[model samples]
Target chain A: MQKIELEISFFGAFRKYERTGPLRLTLAAGAGMAAVKAAIAEALDPAASDLLKVSALADAQQVLSSAHVFDTSAQLVLLPPVSGG
Target chain B: MSQSPDTRSIHVCVRETHLSLEKASAFVDAGENGAALLFVGRVRNHNLNKPVSGVSYDAFAPLAETVMGEICVEAQAQFGPDLRLYIEHFKGYLPIGGISVIIAVGSPHRAPAYEASRYLIEELKKRVPVWKKEHYLSGDSEWLDGTSLVENP
Candidate 1:
């Protein structure tokens, strides 16, 4: 497996941990969404883990499940549970 | 998601500007659909005994829009195909008493319009990729996560 660069976008309080914005992570090229998400959770401070795990990923169209496969796309979105009324 | 963005009889958006009730009502307004149900979400002054300064809304734009559009579609399907739906949410900082969200539905009858309007707001709260940060008067800002802060259970 080759290492590839992926950028993860965050919202809500997760933004505080990712102040640099769109955190850049290097992971196996063929990693699936769940794997990358695991890595992200492990990389973050404990306080941010639940904030990330309870979230979903997004590309340009819609929110993706953890089953999606990663590719060369540099940008990904982390959407935490919403509370809009 | 629909193949073409323009195909749906609904509107979805996530923006930094204030939401507009008139715009939402106009979009779905039709002569045949006399029932226009509008729900406006505004920022209140206090939460849990703390004076709320305001709120900042952040969203996964593409995903938020997609989910909102899908919600509108589902409401239409459940209510009636002729149901016209308009939904929007505001990003950026909204001061206390500011309008943050607008859900407008025009239907052939009042019952469907009322039911669909309620469904749109409830589902939007649960499913949309939007987050609200409450900036309290105590100089602390807190993320309103999930249904955790729902009052009265």
Candidate 2:
């Protein structure tokens, strides 16, 4: 089993949540984004999968669509769309 | 186009109507701006047919500041050397029509300043970790859901 290192940032209410971590999830070589998100949910906050919206980026610039597969190491940012003036 | 913090300028305070035009002007001067555009956000007294008595705001300060800084960096990167930007949001109680946030952008040309200022406010509202609670005269208090009030139990 190959391991992929994922760096995650939790913002807003997620930051105040107890189970948060700068999580690292290992998956098979051709793991998809969905699989990675599931792993993150299980590791960090299982309720995160329901309460928050997740977006993934590779190398900080490229936004990955939900159907996209994770090919290498990447940064995954979770955002819940908090309000500001 | 210097990245050094401007000691003379003051970031606008939360729940205040008056923006420090003086500091904003200084920021423009530091940016060597020929054109400056500022956007002020105000509180509304009503939401979805409900009367609003006032508002209370909450924020994750460290993260909010970092995100605001990132927004400034991105605006600069997109608009280049001719552009400078400032963004401030109010964090406490604000009455109807009170200024809640201010965003100012300066550029050599009018177009970039206007566009960047608008984009900054839009993106900040959508992405920042700030929440607002709305209190009504009828003893009802609810959190604002984006621009609307969400009913709470």
Candidate 3:
């Protein structure tokens, strides 16, 4: 059994937790974004689950599809629904 | 400004300081283009019926800049090739009446200029990776509701 750690950065309403710095998410090796989301849902307060369900996940370059899988540790960003003009 | 060096028709950026409408106006100025439309979005003092003191914007700068450039290209494609566009969104805390965003469009005709300007602002609101937190006069703060980027929950 192998494990991977992801550093998750937060934005928007999620910034409340961002002050603690990037959250370290642990997942099984070969896990995908769905797993990552579930892990985060478990790690944070239940109140944030509603927002998490609607948020988008990204790496350094671009947003990731739910199907995106991880083979190595990575730095990820969480984007809640955006409202900028 | 991050733009194509050769054409220089499009300029898009997310600044940590402040955005200048005058500079945006100058960037889109062209002799052949008869219409230049500039739209500046300012931070107001209230939101959701609550009085606000100021706002702080958080942005994923790299991705925001990329999406903004794509939007400028889309506007040009729909409007006309000769269009010049400028978009700048501010980062950090802004006091009431501060400038939050600016969109400038220069087109060969007034019609396209107006259409493109509207399109840029609307799309920027929905697509950019930026968020705002409103600090209230009551000493509370909250993030405003926004358009969801996820396809399915």
| Candidate 2 stretches greater than 4 Å from native | A1-80, B1-19, B147-153
**Global local distance difference test of model 2:** 0.63
Better of 1 and 3 by TM-score: 3
- lDDT against the true structure, per candidate, is 0.80, 0.63, 0.88
Whole-model lDDT, candidate 3?
A: 0.88
Q: Candidate 2 lDDT, tens digit per residue, B13-45? A: 233345565666566555456787778788888
* Residue B136 shift from truth in candidate 3, angstroms: 1.4
List candidate 1 stretches off by more than 4 Å.
B1-8, B147-153
| Candidate 2 chain B, poorest ten consecutive residues by summed lDDT | B144-153
lDDT at B110, model 3: 98
- Sorted on TM-score, best first, the list reads 3, 1, 2
Per-residue CA lDDT of model 3 for A1-85, tens digit only, reads 6888899998889988776799998788899777889998888889999999999998756778888888888998999999897
lDDT minimum window of 10 residues, candidate 1 chain A: A64-73
Better of 2 and 3 by TM-score: 3
Could you report the DockQ of all the candidates, in the order they appear?
A: 0.47, 0.19, 0.77
Per-residue alpha-carbon lDDT of candidate 3 for residues B1-153, written as tens digits (9 for 90 to 100): 333322489999999987998899899998998999999899998777999999999999988888888888888888887899999999999999999999998888999999999999999999889999999999988888898878766
Backbone clash numbers for all candidates listed = 0, 1, 0
Model 2 residue B20 lDDT score: 63
lDDT of 1 by residue, A1-85 (tens): 6678888877777787686667788987878977888888877888877566667767767666655777664687766777876
